[model samples]
Target: MRSKGERLRRRRSAGSRLSTGSASELQQYSELLHASPTNPYAPFDSKIDWEVARWAKLRGPGSNAMTELLKIEGVCDSLGLSFKDTDALNRMIDNLPGRPAFKREEVVIADEAFEVYHRDVIECIRALYGDPEFAKDLILLPERHYADADKTIRMYSDMHTGKWWWNTQKAVERETPGATIVPVIISSDKTQVTLFGNKTAYPIYMTIGNLPKEIRRKPSQGGHVLLGYLPTTRLEHIVNKASRRRTLANLFHSCVSRILRPLKKAGEFGVPMASGDGIYRRLHPIFATFVGDYPEQLLVTGIKTGECPKCPVPHNELGEYGDRDKLRDIEQVLNALSSITDGNPLVFVKACAAAGIKPVQHPFWEGLPYVDIFQTITPDILHQLYQGVMKHIISWVTKACGAAEVDARCRRFPPNHSIRLFTKGISTLSRVTGREHSQMCQILLGLVVDVCLPDGHSTATLIKAVRAILDFCYLAQYPAHTDETLNHLDEALQQFHQAKHIFVLLGIRSDFNIPKLHSLLHYIASIKCFGTTDNYNTEYTERLHIDFTKDAYRATNHKDEYPQMTKWLTRREKVLRHEKYIKWRVAGCPPPDVPQTDGMPDPRDLGSRPHLRMTRHPTVKAVPVSTVKLQYGAQFFEAAFARFVVQYHEPRWTAFQVEQAAANIYLPFQRLPVFHKIKFWIKDPFHRGLGSETSDAVHCSSIWA
Candidate 1:
């Protein structure tokens, strides 16, 4: 034997490491003893230490070298096995890896194949072959050799197969446009590498060495090697297409599933696909279909859509990494967290702390408590904060129209979160504050415009801010303010469009450009264009801060000037219904409560619906815009106001609003939103009588609904 071989031989026969038998006898016995448990030495009572020893001896000295023979005896016996044939000897050898370790082996990884060297791996195998039984039962996969230019070696194996795994029958499971296979999982890693695509067609080959000296020393070990090759590229093509055809709701339902892990509260939402990035990335393709375009950017998940910042930072330690892959900081932070949690956490308080992962004195920790009214904030705290922010913004705006302080506040707040909270405060307090449209527009304008667009933030982060702002505008009950906010918005939007177009245009990334942004923008334009005070015969729409209590509609009773609140609410109901219908069609089913209409039209495919044409509103008109419906809208609001006050017992809304409502919803010159327009009389509001007929006769409109 060569020097390395002699060292291994000397080490193996070290008497303390190997059994009393010669190497051949030891190998033979080890193999028999460790043979699949079904062939256990059924002659002894496993509970006896002597019986366990006898069984181990019976099993042979092959590779089943016993170190802590007693510890593993219980496990072996339960598995219907005697200790003679054991994996213990292999493990004991590994516990001492420094003995001539790293000697080159018959095991060589090259040319898409692995080899076992004559001197090393073979010697290890020879040591393992002391017993005939275990040796006969075990066989490493054959070497890979490409027989021709087109031929390639492929291999596969999985452990712990459950009922879901094998059918002896290989079949394709259908998801969107094609059939796919979800293969059985074989191992566990803290952060797993998930390979997406149809698992059935993808061959995953793994190799494990029967070496006794290696596994115990290296805990971060790979028992197997993985291949990134697939014979056909067809799996990629099919998976991509199927993902593109799915709806956001359905796509989420299809590819990824969330588990209520025992991490936080009653549970935490754990990403099931964490073990494999390939599987998680497939989620992006599905979201692409929802946007009607590829997403330019998307967070890794739980960043925007998840419940607050509630993820546990793992055992991490941060580093000052000069490289661009910024995860180094997170890694260090995780290690510190692990040290605190003692490597595992099962309860809520600890879970929350783990999720926050903040060191006791971190600066960001203080502001987190007041983040939202939804989680732990009491009603009192919520009310106080709401009032405080609104009042504070107003006082600041009044005192510092051009003050450097005002500009500084706007600049200091990141486009993320701080601005979103400001916007949410504005929207929530609109009914209470009675702030003027024009002044509100400018304040909002200032915030959106002040963010110095920097490569300093992720593009995904910027898009989130933009989306939040757009949603805030819509929810504030002020669709007509869009064009008014236009110039401000266009400038803000320019930052996102110009710099992000490259990725947004390509299908490669999916962090930016989701459906809600564009759809909400489009709706804002649609409603604002048609709903104006021109119909109310009021010219004050152009003013910055017309006090609502002092508007012309108060004197006019605004019946003739604004659209009815009843009409507007009725229209909103329709939009909701239409959205519901679109969701169903995409899911290839009917929405619940949807009556069989024999041939109810698909909402998303409604390209042929005949809508009454209203050409009166001039195209391209901006804020406080006028459309033909304004003429009839004034009359509409008068009727709507009378209707609203009587039916719902709602407070006397400012005449300013009554007039705006009339111009927006009731007139025939312009129809309400689509779902209502499509089946206006068909859908009934909860507990309300049929369509506008009864509403018209009673002079009652419902703002509450």
Candidate 2:
């Protein structure tokens, strides 16, 4: 009898053979490309004639295996193209004399290059589908789209750099997530044109990043690829040549409107435009405007103002504007945009030149049929929070305060006990807070407890102000509380501005200006107007670009970088799709659930403590409180140095947990003996508050008073 391992191997081998045989059978159903029966080695262009003949000779005379696959009837068909058997052809090509290289001189025109790729990309897109839930619901219509453009330099040589890109959308649903489908490349032969406020024409390059279904079928078998490049061109190439003023908005409108016109027409088709493999996608107009960053928005929209383009108030040079009398509303913003004369460059330019309020010149957004400036522009939350405020404030805190605290404490303790702040700086802050501004408020409150900072200290005040804004972001979800939160945030902002000299007092430089520190202010009003902070956030879009950057590191050809990006995107999508399919299969037939284990009963029950029912859990027995992590309403505090004692667990209460405690349990970290009951939402602690002690007893308010 064969060994069990040998029997298993034989079974696996038989299964593989069966699968391969079935795949071949399925390929027979493909008629277009597979049944063409043309010579595979035939060359379409004279440029590859020498290579073609060598391939024929390598296959040996009359073997017919090396016949040009391209010339095969129906072989070029989308369905047939995917099923082509390239093993024989690949083997033949591998034995050729030298590796293939790009012939740049033979490159097609940018417009022609874009069309060839766009046609195939559109075909592929038509085959895939979007989340039906997102498409059907009007509320979710805004969620289905995000538009942002970024330029990355592709080096052909040390001195020669080219840029190209195409607009595309990625599908995200719980079941089949992260499917990036490429859209058409919007490029033209006349790539450069001067726009309003520009002295020269800016060159245009639109490269669609998508991979053929054939290539994407099995990405893991080989190294990842980045191959779908429409063409390469430069932005500054035309800008450098133009000697007259050009408006960026005009150029964007002229180019994009033309591109969208075709797509707008395509949306009328009743048949799901693109459907295959049980997935379908629709070509629809984008609703949200999620651009790369503030500068890009300013450039693209022809709005020179550094403040948010949608702000109703006239933002100052410092990008700071807040008026109690003139709170932001859609009506006021529309009136301001309407003041800019349509198509009259002189009038718009003169309006922009005025100091207080500048007029928006973009014809595409400002007074377009039903759309208003408020709907067209949105503040980038990622840049405002993570890259901007969180990063800057953390830097200021570390340099001016955290470092001092660390140094002061380090010398007093042993090397092992030496205190250090979060080593990753703002990144650590971001990870802890994430999208929850309330959680950030918790972290900020922790800083006070961690460093033993007094409540009235300037640094403490700054943190408070920062937390106030974060809390506003967190609590803004409640429509009833939105105005209240905004008011609190305004107060916090004022306090922070008043304490500007505090940074200097803490040894920060004198040149620190409030305007530079106030970029976060622009996002607040917009948040109230938009109903959520996520509406304008670039967190997802920026993350996608980050993935692109990381994948680009694998590219060997610096000159032709677009193809590498396309290949990476395709491979990533394929991997995600395969994973989704596997998950779907598993979901249909779920594994048996593991038996549940009984957890140890509360220790108090096993012990002689008959009073355990008085509290949710047992309170630590008379132990000194090393760190008092307390929550009172939305307020959260984690104090490492503040001292108190575990008197008793306060019995469950509807609104508050009052603890009667003795002060100065630890001499160095002592606090007032006056007992207090902390009030906070009950559900909050379960979600975020971990390792906190339940109050042992109800504090007597009258006794403390």
Candidate 3:
């Protein structure tokens, strides 16, 4: 066993050498933890109390090692094990050295215990096993900080965001097109006012971790990481338009400059960039911008457009772009924005000037890849669809739509037995938000022409047009239909434009004219060119900021918040790295299961279809027919057999359901019951695709005709 001082010295020495790639760093950290007989990095051990206590004291005041010892003792006692006697523990606690006074008392004393733990234990591990220059990379002292400044911040690098970008980039590159280099998608949004209690207004930008697989896939999963933040208080100081514009421009420039630094370095060095850069382009500039509201979009692009920002189409008030496909030119838009002059000073000049300590640039026009800017800065689906169009339409229909009684009107689809019967099941506008309204749109659009309205009359046609626009929000599940979906959406928007006068009858005019409503026409084109709405939307970015706001609020010290934030973020990285290391060590190749089935289900299948069954299992006498939808790991079963089994249940049910069922049953079930194990072969009569494939009774047991 080593003394506390000896371990500290060892960690400090080893920490310096951990400046390598993630794998090498992990290995080095693992080796350092194993250097001492009692590894501090490992799960808690009561036996190492003296060393642990001493380590805590090194962190700062307020960490009573005695409390930690007590916690360990309590855990041991709960497990019916004996802990070191209280007298011995007291002796150890009493002898522990006093907490060291780090220059900043406020920073050392965290508002929460987790902060303390992160600062003490996690940070020590990070310092020892992680990037040694993590803190140094963000903070600059002597030159930047005041003479008396205990802590000063130059910048903050969020570790989780970095890791996510790294991991996601790796996955995408490895799994998808290896040669294609996608630029980072940076999403910015103003968080809820007072989201951080006293720290009310924190507007932040984040790096999206993953790219959606295809046009239909939503890029909402895989948490986005923060790249930059601006406090509203800072904005309040720039009262005059010139100063305000300059300050905002500076803030945007500095933040973007930092983000682009790695890529820029890569460009200079002729090396692939850091944090998931590709060989093709060393500096993949900001190609996509996802923003919550219109103001942020204005800030990013520095210009408001009369037409859709994405396509070469002219904007129409009725949510339609006629046969004209003239997308706005990036250069033209940039010229328009740069043309604005305040007292002979061009806005561009003021924006790019180094008026403050840091230099500024037009983040979108100047900072972005020139060719990508046109489609890069477009409408966010979250605000445009749910919060914008859906919200507006619902509010209008329920409140001001020329219906005598809102409830009675929405509840009944206007008359004619010749038309489709409308389901009055949609809730009142007050009860549902934009997401729900989009879902309703999906259901309404799927109805047959006669079923959608009272008659094939003009009123019914108008209602159909309205629903069609909402239906456009849903990206088609299959790639083949995506283009068709976009075309249909365009046609629907055109029809809406032609018949928008119907909304006037419903007393909905001004609301229909919002740019987002018109911009919805471009989503299909975006998906066709870029990917899913998630690929460039701010949904994930906004959600991640909620957590960041909480973390920022925890650090009450605003004077040197950058240092505190770096520490917090680095600690988080160390924790995630440790977890990932453990996972890699423990994880084996995933047991062979089913190949993912793509595309829409075969159109031949009808409702209440018969079930398919599998024939074999190593453990069970007969595998369940329900297992046909699951991944088969049986050595006796061939890959073809596995695919056959999976396809039988999959097109009828979703691939998601099939995978989920595999996890639920195939992964856990030791053996299937005889009843579930019953197997048979079912053939499709409609398609005449005669197959000798197996079928299960268990799956179709519920679908008795």
**Count of backbone clashes for each model?**
69, 38, 14
**What tens digits encode model 1's per-residue C-alpha lDDT throughout 1-705?**
122223322433210121122333322332433423331221222325323443332232322245444356466555553333444422322232111121111211112222111112212222222212123222211112222344332111111011111111011111121111111111110111123522221112112222111211121121122211112122233356533222222222111121101111111111111110011101000000000011111111212221212122221211111111112134333344345345343442253344443222121111211111111110111111123223333443333233344445544543331112243334324445323432343345444343433334343443443444433443333212333344344444444344433233323234433322222222223222112111111111112011111121222233422222222222222222223333333344433332222133423222344333333443323312132125323434446644565445435766676555545544343333211111112223453321111111112112221
Ranking by TM-score: 3, 2, 1
- Model 3 over residues 1-705: C-alpha lDDT tens digits? 222223322433211221234333334545644523343324324334423333333232232443555567465466432334444433433332211111211111112111111122112222321222121221100011111233321211111111223232333334322212233455556555343455444434443212222211211211234444443434554468666665665455444444444443221222222221101122222233444566666565544344444554434443445433345555554554454434345554544332211123445335333234555554477777777776666554444323344334334654332232334544433556545655545444333233322222355655655565555555422222333455665676666666656566545564354677766665555544444454455555565654555455444355646445544444334334343333333343211111111112322233334454455553334555455335342343334444556667676867676655554433335344332234445555555332123343422221211
Best by TM-score: 3
**On residues 1-705, what C-alpha lDDT tens digit does candidate 2 reach at each position?**
222223322432211111111211112212212322343222111214423333333223332343455547774453233223334433433332221111121222212222211223223333222211112211111111111122121111100010111111212112122222232222221211113322211222222213221111222211122212223233343454332124333444443343333333332221233221223333332222323455555544444444544434444434243442232355544454455647675655554544223343333333322233343344455555555555555556556546556344333432121123333333334334334432233344444334543334555555554565445344433222233455665676666555555555666546433322444464444443333443334443433332334343233244444444344344334333322222323344311121111122322122233322343333333322322323222122222222122323323432222222222224453232323432222222444322122423332232112
TM-score head-to-head 2 vs 3, winner: 3
Q: TM-score per candidate, in order?
A: 0.18, 0.43, 0.53
Better of 1 and 2 by TM-score: 2
lDDT of each: 0.26, 0.33, 0.40
- Which one wins by TM-score: 1 or 3? 3
RMSD of each: 31.8, 20.9, 17.5
- For candidate 3, the TM-score is 0.53
Winner by lDDT: 3
Cα-lDDT of candidate 2: 0.33
Q: Report the CA-based lDDT of candidate 3 relative to the real structure.
A: 0.40
Worst 10 residues of 2 by lDDT: 157-166
